[model samples]
Target chain A: MKADNAAIVRFENLTLGYNHHPAVHHLHGEVAPGTLLAIVGPNGAGKSTLLKGIAGELRPFQGTIHLHGVRKENIAYLTQQSTLDNTFPIVVQDFVAMGLWRHFGAFRRFDATAERRIAESLAAVGLTGLENRPIGQLSGGQLQRARFAHVMLQDSPLVLLDEPYSAIDANTVHDLAGLVRRWNTEGRTVISVLHDLEHVRSEYPETLLLAREVIARGPTEAVLTAENLKRARQLAEEQGELVGAPVCAADEDAEQAIHAHLGHKHG
Target chain B: MSLVDTLASVPVLSPFIEFAFMRRALAGCLALSLGATPIGVFLMLRRMSLAGDAISHAILPGAAIGYLLAGLSLPAMTIGGLVAGVAVALLAGGVARNSVIKEDASLATFYLISLSAGVLIISMRGSSVDLLHILFGSVLALDDTALLLLAAFASLSIVAIAAGLRLIVLECCDPAYLARISHLGAVAHYGFMALVVLNLIGGFHALGTLMAVGIMILPSAAARFWVQTIAPLILVAIALAFAGSVVGLLLSYYVDLPAGPAIVLTLGGLYLLSMIVGPLGPLVSRRRPRWHFTR
Candidate 1:
């Protein structure tokens, strides 16, 4: 039970899970300010769940996740792009504008200054002209960029991203990774759950390799050793993690329900 | 006659002008469309359209209890419906989140129980006509109390929605992200759903429970085919609903049909039409493309 006063994020004996089945087990660690860390592990390594814990989406079943000097509102968290309903009738501009929650909040005048910030965010992500296009109309890569632009508006001291580049193209991943690096330079702590070892080794200086529990936590070179990754996979298989909760939309019957209710003959 | 005078003389416009009931029905439906259409869009985006419907059905038992105690009193029934709707919604949501059953299944279960209990209660005490009025509504016979209730609900709904507009939208688009940023989504989520239930209760008096959910849903479904942004989508949905109400009311006046179903069917017709011919429809967007982009 060591509490690090200097650490931006400290987890002590933390257990997070669904239905009391701990996805992340007794995780104890401290993330220093401005650390660009990648959490890497096997498929069910509790990576996303761990990030969820830090983002305050889940309360720890056992221990504590202490954030020193961080207001809960200033943390920007992005889950899988799949969890986002792109088909929502929101333009890229307004979609990105939501990130300004830390700024304007629910109902504030989005005057010229806020509009400028939105423009700046889109430009940062190279989505200048596509601002008016519906988010549903954007390509996968374009959507990712739009989400990143959203994070830009958040302007938070800490950013937690889950599987940010899982389905992205190599070039887009690189471009987005550059944005992560930019945030790092701006003294923002970015903890991302990523699978690409090469990208992690290249872009992230810190790594936390996990398998329902801490496998390794140190520099990328030390934590991502072949031995540790193998152990993570083995630990994951042996423990047999509980199924993760359904992401944002718990939609099992959406497609059929909509068609049936609308009396769509074309379903 | 002047152009304005000539337009007022149209056969469709005459019924509304000639009858006070028609005017009240038109006002009530328009006000309902203004508030509920936007809520419908949110429900669809959240993939909770059926959940909204379930809440509507869930309100019946509570309203029936009110009816049993007070004999068709407006305030009593309104409070009863609100309590029942919020309770059922919370219970279904809790069970789904905690248990193995999905939300849709849990809601369906509760709605069936609630609806059957409601019907049984009404049949036990009230006459068959009372049951019919509760189920099918009396749009052509709205008293001052129902009209006032509908107007107040509409105004309150508009202000409440505007106050929580950003939270509701962000939550629908990305709930997990919104959760991380603010817990306002939790508040907005329930608040918006309560408004959905509240709007349905208001609409049930004018359009009946059977058709109340239809006005909230069908126009939004139709609007989805044509618009690709929230503001315009809501506008289109409201326009579609208003058009349907006017036409449906006239159709009922001339041909003598149930006003509630007639209005909903007209909305259904509009929905079908949009699917076929809207600019973003399968027929149009596939062939002509709304926007062109390049690498």
Candidate 2:
């Protein structure tokens, strides 16, 4: 991949793994500015691992991950799975305001300005009236929107989401995509790992296919072809046969393979 | 005695004006609550409750060593305890990061090792009564120096928690982002753990190790049932701690009971009340509609 100012992120020969065990090897790619890139792959395909590497949660073993022509910072990441202490006592407004914490000094209080930003962010994510409600009181979709509201409050140019719409309501998924598209139009770069191929095909223009490595990377139409789909299915098959192993890929859906494999792309 | 006289004669209130030791004890109890409650709130939210418990217990060995090295002086013991506490937290964090062992398990292992080491050190150097005073506390015979130490700890904990409030909350909610942008997560964890250690050491004279953990955790747990935001949670926790202190002290003084248990029991009552009256939980506010007859 050629380096350019227009490029927001680049992974050169990136290899992600734990200790000596390699999960993905010799991956090379670049995510362009103002574009939404969807990462699609089978179970154990290292799709999330690739996103983790890009987000700086997981460091690549042998390759270089360069963001904005420099070292990676000013990047916002939302994890695929979060066990939020739902037992946690925090209001939606308070939760969203947390995104502004990095800008404040350790002792600094959230002034009226920060509070205003939190309100705007909540309103942006369609959580206007629910600001004072405790996070525990929110349904799954509402909770995810609240999380998106938090990310919106972060006000970063680069946003990375790991399955942002998973386990969310159809309305919430639509609202979230609208927000992402709005951000995309404003020139913010978005990279999300999506399980739904239909979402990638219809909602996203760019996609990267992976199975422990880069099976393909490019526009959604090119990368998410029948061959790549077969490769992803094969990877899923291999994953099911192996037990007691750490499969970090699309492992969350292997148990419901029957329902998962039926293509939702056309629907 | 009339009901009013009976109430007045209760130890919690009786100690207030009658004797200096009792007054100091009451003050100590209140201060301990203020010191430990906020720390507990953040610790629980961070899912580091066991880490707080571990660090609290782990302070015993250091306090014991401090006693052996510098006798009964507060400063020496405090410095010793702080050092040991920091060491244990760092070791646990390091182990958690490097090894496959989860953070809670690592903390548990650290706590057991440090606590046992402290007991052995105390046994080798001092009498059983002194050890008991250090381990289980002797709230009745607290001196001025003990009061000063407790006050200092309470002040430090309040300040530290106040300063780190936003960062601590943010870190607990979203550590991945913090790690990407700054050192807030790691720093907050260590800083908060240090404060917890200080509070444990400070309360050592009043409640001892076993009972101090209760003071630190119970009030916060009770407070959590009442509020939805971090700021409010801390405020409610502080208030609950104060109430517990006052009631517990009064009850203990008049009824001839230990201050620690009294405070813990009061906190437990608050928790039960919160469970019943809390607005968020299903148990407290079942969704079923209620129809009323003519009132």
Candidate 3:
């Protein structure tokens, strides 16, 4: 919502969509570096679309996202659903080694240091012994751990995760949430789309509650109020059931959200 | 000569040792196996074997058109097939991306249309004898020009595959991530599709359009039953394809069978064998071992 010094990512009235029907409406925000932010929304409320915009997967139809200096090499994004073909014939170690691809590329020989780092990432994710096993043979939890290992190896300044904990056992979630914390501690800007509002309240420092637009954004305590959340859910449910429903005016909702956010600040 | 005497007299090596046509066929098969098998392995790896089949079908009309215009000319048929095959592939893919019809469904629709158009055109302009030649190929009648085209195309295929090796693997494993990191995603995708069409053209020259895809797909599928890594899988597929081609040629020579189907059947036999007995196949590995790991 506000820029401090040089913002890591700044979105200017961004509208992202498919086939001219906007999934994410006009919005403006600036994310400071090293901010541990959580994006919370009802299903189809454009949380993933916002992340996709930041990851450069989707283009904004009518706005700009300035990434100060970050490029593809400096960012790591994990999709909501794994895009990997599990039936592929590749060992876990080799898959994890892809995080180092920006440096060593796909062809270079991984030196001893690179090898050690790969082993370390796998060990950190509790997949050290399973490195030689085919990635397809890994169970869901094991594969998620492997995914985290890959993200760890990315060593990027910006890390984006979409629903990293869905369908995962609680123990695995706790383990992965710890890794997310570790990344923020290392001064990486970490933005995640999470559905577990309770978990976000306890862990994420900043929260953006979105339902096709910014419903509330700022400190977790100020944004996750009961009134704002109920309103957000009601807005989402109104449009969720309709097939090709008429869109509400985007700027009108933005005005209401701004007023509500201001009232929270003064209160 | 009687069938038994014919088989006995010719033996294994004499097919090539005695006949100029047989020698030429062997050389053609060698070039084809070296180039096409790797592309087939990639097709299998991407799980686009069906797409490969569709493109093979899509090229039929192009080849038939060439036959109508030039009367069994190699360069004419090859260029026509390449143009038509790539066009259909791109069209289907574009429709899938721009609309809601999904890629496989779009490919199926376009290939059927293409096949019917080709069959109708050939029937209108050419005789059934010409149709059979285009459909089943004239491997024994491949001229020096055809032989040179095969060798040159095969060399080009190997070098192209090597150049795109890393991008291809990266695109296969995680393409969205690759796009996030670099702009090579389109190059990898279009380049791989181009290779698929190129190899199908080669396969159509050796086998008919109907069985061309069979040769490309079956050997690779069988190789997967045996090998777990990409490199070994491709190598085994190449070896299996070459062996199947040679043996099929010999079997056709002695038994008076159609060579294209014979080659495909030989590859099918190897696929079945691998499915039963290869180390990673169902019969060999999928059963319960009645044992557990102990620390």
Chain A only TM-scores, each candidate in turn: 0.87, 0.83, 0.89
Docking class of 1: medium
Q: Clashing residue pairs, candidate 2? A: A45-A212, B11-B250, B11-B253, B11-B254, B12-B249, B12-B250, B61-B118
Model 2 per-residue lDDT at A264:
54
lDDT for position B62 in model 3: 94
For model 1, residues B1-295, the per-residue Cα lDDT tens digits are 8775676698978787768999998998888898777788788878888888888887788889999999988888888888998898889889999999989899889979988999999998999998888887888888899999998988988898788878888888888777766768789888887888889889888877666788888999999898888888888988998899888998898899988888889999999999999987888888874457653
RMSD of each: 9.8, 8.8, 6.5
lDDT of 2 at A260: 50
B122-194, model 3: which lDDT tens digit per residue? 8988889888877887778778988887788788889988877877887988887787787778988998899
Tens-digit lDDT string for candidate 2 (A86-122): 7567788777776785666456777889888888888
Q: How many clashes show up per model?
A: 0, 7, 0
lDDT of 2 by residue, B46-142 (tens): 7777887787777788887888987766677667777887788788889998999988789889888988998898888889987777777766677
- Candidate 2 chain B weakest ten by summed lDDT: B286-295
Pairs that collide in candidate 1 are none
* Per-residue alpha-carbon lDDT of candidate 1 for residues A30-93, written as tens digits (9 for 90 to 100): 9998889999888887898888788787888667899986777678888764567867888999
Going through the candidates in order, their DockQ values are 0.57, 0.41, 0.48
In Å, residue A200's CA in model 3 sits off its true spot by 2.5
Stretches of candidate 3 exceeding 4 Å from the true structure? A1-5, A19-21, A105-113, A225-228, A234-267, B1-10, B123-127, B282-285, B289-295
